[model samples]
Target: MDEQGDPMPGATVKVKGNEGNGVLIGTVTGPDGKFSLNVPDRKVMLEVSFVGYVSRLIAASDTVSLKKVVLKEELKNIEEVVVTGYQRIDRKLFTGAAAVIKAEDAMVEGAIDVSRMLQGKAAGVQIQNVSGTFGASPKMRVRGASSINGNQKPLWVVDGLVLEDVVEVSADDLSSGDSETLISSAIAGLNADDIESFQILKDASATALYGARAMNGVVVI
Candidate 1:
């Protein structure tokens, strides 16, 4: 359904689960704006996307069946406020390589964590889902790696509090098993429901405010 309660057609429906690692099933809505997908019995995320509207994510359980869904049309020219290091500024006045993802926009279907929400959303930002274990977080690099010996992960700040990157992986862990043991990111502790928005700073112009600490990049939440 559309925001006006009218039936919509041609909307995309995708299902993702651990078995698929990504999209397991993809289909389009019928002429009456109804869709039925046969997904695996395991836990999955259902993504509904339509052009000119905001996409919605719905988590699915074994017994879950979607009865109704609505898509809201996009609003243009709405000013957005973003956090740039120590200050909040209007997005129009900011001049730098940065991207902002609101909570609604970040919540994609099949996303297990916040880092997964950022995959391919930002231009210079790269997100690699290296681990499939429970409670694991993906590896993120901003504007590529800058230092050989230093940490390559982006700095994460939640509600003005800087978070520490605690990823540690031994070389032996990679070669010894079919599935490499990946260290979870400290940001994995955050609750996705509590996050309002996230701003990623990619270039020096946007990250200089944090100095050396943001050499890799900055993810301000």
Candidate 2:
């Protein structure tokens, strides 16, 4: 479970062995945030990991066997060092127009999906809700209005890899008010609380690294 006691589905659980490079067993949490595994040793090390949350290592003991474990949110400060995907630089030495929104700061109550979270969080970044359906993604613009239609979308990046839209649909259909077509999004199925932070690049020097794909600007998560 997360700090808020929310069930974390699909969280990975691993059993660590002694010494180096040893993995005994592994499993994932279910929808109810419960997992079970039989280990070879009575006392084993368990590592729980979920995206954007701090990982925890626990000792498998009789007392804690059936108890619930909580994973805290990862609060990382980017003022010390700046990891801009392509390179690493000191924050003071780096000069670029970038805005960061921490998960805790931008979170809305009862909001598992973040399509509306970025609405007014970052500067120069505009977000419009294309659909009101559950898990639907919002339309986003880094500098300009979403008036050009959905001809293109801002590049989606996680860690250092780029993500492509899974569903291919035209802007005309999306704005047609049809509920089915409006239920499209890249991170719709993702839990907003799992995100650590959002880095918005609003300047040329900051977005030049992505070339044409980032012509609209860059959003790093």
**Which candidate has the top score in lDDT?**
1
**1-221 in candidate 1: lDDT tens per residue?**
99788888899988754434653587899999988788775466888899779988787663343667878898666468778867776788777778988888888876777888888777878887654566566667886867666567777888777887554543233233333243446576677888888899887775557677787788998
* lDDT digits (tens) for residues 120-201 of candidate 2: 8877778876666665566677867544654556676777777666776666666666665544555566677678887777
In model 2, where is the ten-residue run with the lowest total lDDT?
A: 145-154
Write down the TM-score for model 1: 0.56
Worst 10 residues of 1 by lDDT: 171-180
TM-score of each: 0.56, 0.56
Clash counts per candidate, in order, are: 0, 0
Estimate the lDDT of model 2. Answer: 0.72
Residue 81 displacement (Å), model 2:
4.2
